[model samples]
Structures are given as structure tokens and as C-alpha cells.
Target: MAPTRTGSKRLLHDLNQSIVFNLIMEHQAISRIKLARKSGLPASTITKIVGNLLAAGLVLEVSADESSGGRRPVLLSINASAGYVVGVRLREATITLTICDLQCNSTYTRECSYQPGTAPQQVITIMATAIRDLVAEAGLTMQQIFGVGIGLSGLIDSARGLCRVSTILGWQNVELGPALERQLKIPVRVDNDVNTLSIAEHLFGQGREADNFLLVTIGRGIGMGIVLGGAIYRGSFGGAGEFGHMTVDVRPDAPLCNCGKRGCLEALASDYGIVRTALGTDPGHAIEDAIVNLIARAHAGESEIVAIFRQAGITMGIAIANLINIFEPSHILIAGEGLRAGDLFLEPMRQTIPRHTFDARDDIELLICPTSDDLWARGAASLILHEIFQSPIYEDEEALALDDLVSQASKAQKHHKK
Candidate 1:
């Protein structure tokens, strides 16, 4: 059904406001004229939209900037403290939580060790308690938080808020979102750990400037996230970014992957794969110390170990090149725990990618993102913050009406106190 005339007008207003708000957020302190030009909105329209944002305390006017020609323009900036959000990275070994301001800055963080195969409900409880403790440490109440975002290793059904399969956590079809929300009494968004990192890279990291890019995380496992046409491209069932499962080598002797498949890219490229290769050479070595010792040996001029790392890199490069040939993204970000090996591991990829990629794009930019546990937590928080800023046009009327009620109640409470 077509929207009513009033509904259409409201939608247009919300869209224009979102555009102006996003422009200011991205450009930092931007002048109204610059916002107008960037957003392709008329000056009058920009002014009206900015006025609404300013009144809502979502925008702030910073010091005037030197004018290009006319009077000095007042630069607009996002009010980073207008609200806050929580991000949690649920891992097999631990649960990490971070509180971030509107600007995606981490204000407080907490982490706690957990058993590798902790039950889903217990994980939710731990997350809720950690969120509460983190908020208390930040000296903020629950009302200050917009929402909670969680990232875990798995095949996430994001729309359903379920972790359909998580080899790391031994979870299958866990209703993570509903369980967390039930305890916290707030909105919760759950997604794959790499997908959350991709969101962070898209909004705050190297991918911030590119509308089209690919994020490849090579660590204990291999995962890929594609941002096409300015949004994450989750396949028909939110399983699109499973690049680790992509078959890269069909040779009969290829290493075995955790997915019970042979010749998969992850079987050759992930940290586990690298460790598996090392086991073949350094027999009976301390399995737990395999990755650390393997990289050390390769760096110490061990030709055989270096060759194994090189083979992993070569296989990774082929898969990455194939993806580039198909997607032609503006940039490809390679990140994860495995990147700590530095150029020792990446030089081979750097050399092999160009040899395989098609013309022109062979020189595609590759950005290495050095990731840590904290960054993953921050990424989780960014996920929720991203949703909080979504244009109201996409929200159902009931949700909008509930938001209006909340705003009205807050205003009334303030008036009553006065």
C-alpha cells in the first residue's frame, strides 16, 4: 500500500535529517554549506534538518571555520555524549564488554573468563551482569544506553537474532538476542564476530571512505564480510560471508578443515591450518604452542616452516584475488589475530595476488588491520550504535510511537523537576 501523504512527508523529513546527521558525523566538524553540498540538499533544507538535530541535542555547533569566501561558517559536529551503547564480544575463552559513546569511543570496558562450552543462558547472564557493571563503572544508568550489541564466532542468523552454528562455542540455533534482551530489558543485536568487525571497519576503520570493500579475517578461522553499495551484503539467508568454506584447492592431499571438508581455503590459510601444517614438520611439538613457535621458527630462518607459511599465504592470495576478480571492490582489508606474524606471512600474499588477479585491479589496495580483543568488543558496540541512528522512515509506526512516548515522558519528568 502507498504511504499516506502525511506519512510520505514524515518519511522525507526523517531521511533528510538522517542524511544531514550522517554527513556531519562522517566529516567531523563540517560547515552547513559543506553538509549541504555533500548531501546534495538545498541550503534551506539543510538548515531545517540541522535545526531539528540541534534541538534534539544530537548535533552540536563547534567553533566557526574560516570561510572559503563569505562569512565564517558555523561547523556542526555530532554530540558524542548524547547517548551511549554497549558492545560485547562473546568468545570461547572469555566475554568482553565495552561501553562506547555516540562517536564510537570506548568509555569503559570489562572482561571475564568463561568455560569454552558455557551454555547459552549462562552466557547471556554473564553478558547482562557485565553490562551492568560496565555501566556502573561509567557512572551511567541504563537509560543512557541505546542498546547492546554482541558478536560471536558462528553462522549468525542476524534477522532472527540466532547463532545458528558456532563451532567455537558449541552453540546451535541459540536465541542469543531474545535471551539477552529478556534479561536486560533493552534491545540486543547479535551477529558474527567478523561481521561486527566489518561494521567497525566500514564506519571507523579503513573501509570508512569506500562504499565497496571486502573484509577478510584470517585467524583461528577464516571469515569474509562484503560491503557492497554501502551496506553489508548478507546473502539470502545471512550466510554470504562464509569465505572460509569456499573451496580453494581440490587436490586430494589438501589439509583437512574443521568443517570436515578437505581442500577448503580455511584448511590452508587459517591459524589452525598453519598450525596443522607445522605439525607435519615439527612432529610431537607442544600443540598449544604451535602457532607462536611456528611463526618464530619461520622468522628465525627455518626454510621449511617458512615454506609452509608461504603456502598458506599463496592459497589465501588466490582466494582473495578470485574474490576481487568477481567483486572489484575498492579495497580489501586483511585482518585478525594471524596478522601478528606481520610481513613474514603477508609478503607471499603480496607477491602472489598480482600474479593471479586480472588486469588493472591487480594493484588493488590491501589494508592490514591489526586486531585485538578490545577492538572486537568496540566493534560489537558500534553495531548497536549503527542501528540506533537508523532513519525512522524504516521503523514501524508502533516503534516510532513508543519512542515518541519515551521522549515525551523524559521531557515531562524534566519539567516536573523544574
Candidate 2:
């Protein structure tokens, strides 16, 4: 369907606001003149936009800049305390909740675990409670929060807020977002965990300067998020970045993946794959203990353990090479909980990418960003923040009217108290 004239104008305004907000964040402190120049917007347009931003408390005016033979211009910077957002990251073993301010600084975090076979409602109740506790701990009400963003490992139908499939959590067609929204009475956005990481990278991490990048996360599962032309490339069904399911081998005896497939890259290189390999040498160790011992043995220079890590690296390298050859991203960031194995897995992975990559393509920067569950949670928070900036609240007359009414009420209350 074609966008209407009003819709087009609204979109333009949203884009302008986002562009201005990002500029202020990047430059730290910039004058209207510089913002207009950098953003290529007219001076009048910048002035109008800046006024809305200031009124919204998204940007603050700082000290005046040195003038070039004219009136000194005030600098503008992001208002880190303007509002807050909540991020929830759901994993197989645990669910993490975090509340972050406008600048994405985590002010509160809570974590709780759920055993396998636990009902989704049980997990949701725990998460909702944690969110409320975090908000109370921060001494803020729901009105102070912009929204909530959820990052989960699964085949997410983001538009519908459904987890179409999640092998890690054993979920199918789970209406996670709608269910949570009903409980929390707040706006919600849900996306694949790796996609959330991509949002974090684009806004705050290594991809801040690169328009094209791929983020590959390796941990309990393998996942990928692709950013192209400065936005997430969520294919037709929001499942475009399923890199883990790509076949790396077809050997009949290859270990099975959580998805029930055999010979997939994730089956060979993920944490599960590493521990499965370790079972041969550390015969009696449980899965959890086996992983701990696997890393220790590799660090201790055990040839057998070292070989297992090396093979994982080779499979990972193959995956990396394919991404580069297919996407040609300017940057490829490999991150997640599993990288704690240090260089035991990386050195071999690094050594294998060059062998398969096309000439010159192999030179693309590969960044191994060390991340934790908290970072992923922040990534989820970033998704909500990103949307808030793009929302039409700044341009919509009804929203502006509501804000004005709220402000008047607060003032009246304060005057009555005095």
C-alpha cells in the first residue's frame, strides 16, 4: 500500500528527529549551526526540531559555544535522565531484566532462573515481578518509563510479538509480547536476541561508524543479525538472520543440533557441541561440569581438549567466511557468553577464515566483542530507546497537548503545596 501524504510527512519528521538525536549523542555537545551543517537540514528546520526536542526533555542546552564574530550559540546534548526503558533478555536457564536511562546506563538489574519444562506463564510471572521490583527499587513509576524491549533466542514474529519457534526454551507460537504487555500495561517490542545486539552495535558499539555489519553470537546457540544501509535487515518474515541453521557438514554421524538437524554449523561450534566433544575425554563429567573442565583442560595444554576447541574454531571460521562472502559487511562482530574460552577457540577460528574468504574480502575487520547477559539486556533496552526517538510523539499534536496538560497539572500541584 502507498503511504498517504500525512503518513509521509510524519515519517519525515520522525526521521529528522532521529537524525538530530543521533547527531547530538555522537557529537556530545553541538550547536544548532553545526547540527544543521552535519544533518544537511535547513537552519529553520533544525531550530524547530531542536525546540521540540528541548520541550520533550530529550536534549538539553549546554554552555554557549565560542562565536565567530557573532552571537554565541548554545550547545545541545542528550538528556540522559529524561526517561527510562526496561530490557528483558530471556534465556534457557534464566531471564534477566534491566532498567536503563536514556543513555542506556543500566540503573537496575534482576535475574531469576527457570527449570526445563517450566510453563511459560511461570516464567512470565517471574519476569513481570522482577520488572516491578526493579522499578520500585529505582523509585520510579511506569509513567517514567518509555517502554519495554524483550530479547529472546528464537524465531520471533516481531510484528505479531510471537516466538514462532524457540528450541532453546522449547517454545512454539508463544505470544510473549502481548502476554507481557497485558501484565505490565506498557508498550512492548520483541526481537531475536542477536538482532537486539545488532541494534546495540549500530547505536553504541563497533558498528556505530559502519553502515553495514554482521553480529554473530555463539553460546548455548548460534545466532546472527545483519545490518544493511544502517537498519536491521529482518527479511520478509523477520527470520532473515538464521545463520546457525546453515549446513557446515553432511556426515551421517555428525552431532544433532537443538533444532533436531545434524551437521549444522552450530552443532559443531556451539557450547553444546564443545561439551559433546569433551564427553569422549572426560567420560563421567555432567554437561555443565564437562564444559568447565573442557575449558580448563584446553588451558592446561591438553592436546585432546585443544583439538576439540580447534575444530569448533574451524567450523566457526567457515561460518564467518560465508557471511563475508555473501554480505560483504564492513565489520563482522563475533560475541556472546561462549567467548570466555579466551583465545583457545578464537586463534583457530581466525586462522581458518582467511583460507576460505575471497581475496581482499578477508581483509574486512573482524571484531571479537566480549559481551555478557547484561550487555544483551542493554541491547534490548536500546531497541526501545531507538523506537522512542523515532516515534511521532514529538510531532503529533495530540501527544504534545497531553504533555502540556501533564506539565500544567504538576505545576498546579506544586503551587498548591507551596
Candidate 3:
């Protein structure tokens, strides 16, 4: 259906407002004239949009230097305190939650855990309780929250806010959005955890300056988030970032992957894969101390362990090289718990990448990002911000409606108090 003229005008206005808002965010304390020039919007449009932003308390006028001659232009900055958003990162047994203000600053965070094999309903209940409790702990009301975003490892149908499948959680066809909204009376978004990390990098992290990049996470599992043409490419079924499962080994004796495959990249190169190789190769290593002890062993010059780590790095490098050749992204961001091994592991991968990559390899920027459960949770929260701040022409209608609901709830709360 074609959009009416009124709808088209509204959308154009929203797009311009987003442009102005993004400019102000990029260059803090920017003048209205600068905004008009940068956004390519007319001066009058900038004034109207900035006036609306100021009236809504979303942006504030900062003190301008009076010594800059007659009538110094007023500079504007985003109101970081305008509202808060909640982010949740769900792991196999633990859920991390955090609250961030408008500027994506973490004001409060907490974690809760459940036993493995817990029912999905029980997990949802626990997550909702944690969110409500944490918000109260932070002295915030539901009205103050813009929305909640949940990220977990799985095949997620983000449009429907449903988990299509999650081997980590043993979940299938779970509706995260409706479930949480019913409990909390607010908006909710759910996505693949790696996708959330990619969104974070695109919006606020290293990928901000680059339009195309790959966010690869190496840990218990290896994952990749592909961004091209300035937007995430979710493939046909939203299962696109399963770079871990890509076949990197083809030998008949290759290690078995948890996905019932042999010679998969994750089977040979993930931290868990390295641990598996270590435990099976040596009889002296009987007890499991997780990846930490394995890293320590490598640091202490355990030749066998070091070799295993290097092999993992080389395998990952080969796969990453293929990724660079295929996608031709300008940057690659490596982040995950697996980084605890430090240079002993990553250096080989970095060196091997160029060896296998095609031409223009030097043009690609490689970045190593520090990762934690907190960062993952914060990345999930940034998904909501991404939905709000993205260019309106490409904005999701459902997300726009949710933002409207959030605003209405806040307005109602303020009016009731009045």
C-alpha cells in the first residue's frame, strides 16, 4: 500500500529530526547553524526540530561562550537523563541485567542465575522478577524506563520477539516480548546475543566509524555478526551469524562439534574446543578448571597447551580470512571471554589472517574489544536505542509503536502526579 502524503511528510520530518539528533550526538554542544548544515536540513527545520527536542526534554541548551562576539549561537546537547533502558544478556544458566540512561551509561546492573534444565516459563519469571527488583533497587519506576532488550544465543525471530531455537537454553518458540510485556507493562525486544553485540558496536563502539564490519565472538561458542551497507544482514531466517558452524576442517578424524558435526570451525577453534583437545591429549590433566587454567598453562609455557591454542588461532584465522574475502568489510571486531588467553592466542590469529586474506588485506582494520557479561547485557540495551535512533526511513514500524507506548506511559505518569 502506498503511504499517504501526510504519512510521507511525517516520515520525512522524523528522518530529518533523526539526522539532526545524530549530528548533535556526534558533535556535542553543536550550534543550530552547524546542525542545519550538517544535517542538510533548512535552518527553519533545524529550529523547529531543536525546539521540539528542547520542549520534550530530550536535548538541552548548554551555556554558550559570550566572548564569541554579538549573540553567540546556542549549543545543544542530548539530555542523558531523559530516561533509562534495561538490557538483559541470557546465558546457559545466568541472566545479567543492566539499566542505562539516554546516553547508554550503565547506572545499575545485576545478575541472577538458575539451574540448568529449568523450564522456559520459570526462566522468564525469574528474568521479570530480576528486572523489577533491579529497577526498584535503582530507585526507578517503570515509567522511567524506555524499554527492555533481551539478548541470548539462539535462532531468534527478532521481528516477532520469539526465540526460534536456543540450544544453550534448550528453548524453542518462546515469545520473549509478549511474556515480558505482560509482566512488566512496558516494551520489550529480543535478539540473538551476538546480533546485540553487533548492534552495540555499530551504534556506540568501534564500528561507529565504519559502515561495514564483522563482530566475531570467540568463547564457549564462536559467533559472527555481519554488517553490510550500514545495516545488519540477518540472512533469510535470522540465523546468518552462525560463523562458528562453518566447516574449517574436513579430515575424517576431526573433532566432533556439539551441533553433531565434525571439523566445524567451532569444534577446532573455540575455547571449549581447545580445552577439549587439552584434556584428551594429556593424561596428567584429569580435572577441569575451565578455560582459565588452560590459559594459565599456556602462559607458563606448556608447549602442548600453547600448540593447541595456536592451532585454534590458525583455524579461526583461516575462517576470518575467508570472511574478509567474502564480505570485504572494512573492519573486524574480535570480542569474547576467550580473549583471556591474551596475545598467546590472538597474535597467531592476527598474523594468520593476512596470510590467507586476498588483496586489500592491509586496508582492513582489526580491533580487539574487551568483553564481559556486563558488556553483553549493555549491548542488548543498546538494541533499544538503535531502534529509536536509526534513520526513520528504515525504522521498524513495530519499534516505533513501542516507543510511542513508552512515551505515552511516561506522559501519563507525569500527568497523574500532577
Rank the candidate models, highest TM-score first.
3, 2, 1
lDDT of 2 by residue, 1-418 (tens): 1122355665676667768877898898999989999999999889988887776666899999888887899999988776778998998778888999878898888887878668888888788888888888887777677678999988898777889988878898889888888999877789999999899888888988999999999876789999998878888888989888888889898777778888888778988788866774322224556677789988888999899888899889878997888999899999987787778889988989988888846559999899988999999998777665443433432122223322433443344346
RMSD of each: 3.9, 4.2, 3.2
Residue range with the least summed lDDT across 10 consecutive positions in model 1: 397-406
| Model 2 residue 75 CA deviation in Å | 0.8
Candidate models: Cα lDDT each? 0.80, 0.80, 0.83
Order by lDDT, highest first: 3, 2, 1
Tell me the tens digit of each residue's lDDT in model 3 across 1-418.
1123345776777777778878888886899878887778898898887877776667889988454567888789988777789999998778999999777789999999898889888898999999999999998887778889999997998888899998768789998888988999888998899999999888888999899999999988899988887788887877999999988779998888767788888888887688778886421222235678888888898899999999899888889999999989989999998888888789899889989988738889999999889899999998888876776665455665323633554474475366
Going through the candidates in the order shown, the clash numbers are 0, 0, 0
> What's the TM-score of each model vs. the native?
0.88, 0.88, 0.92
TM-score winner between 2 and 3, please give it: 3
For residue 410, give model 3's deviation from the true position in Å.
6.1
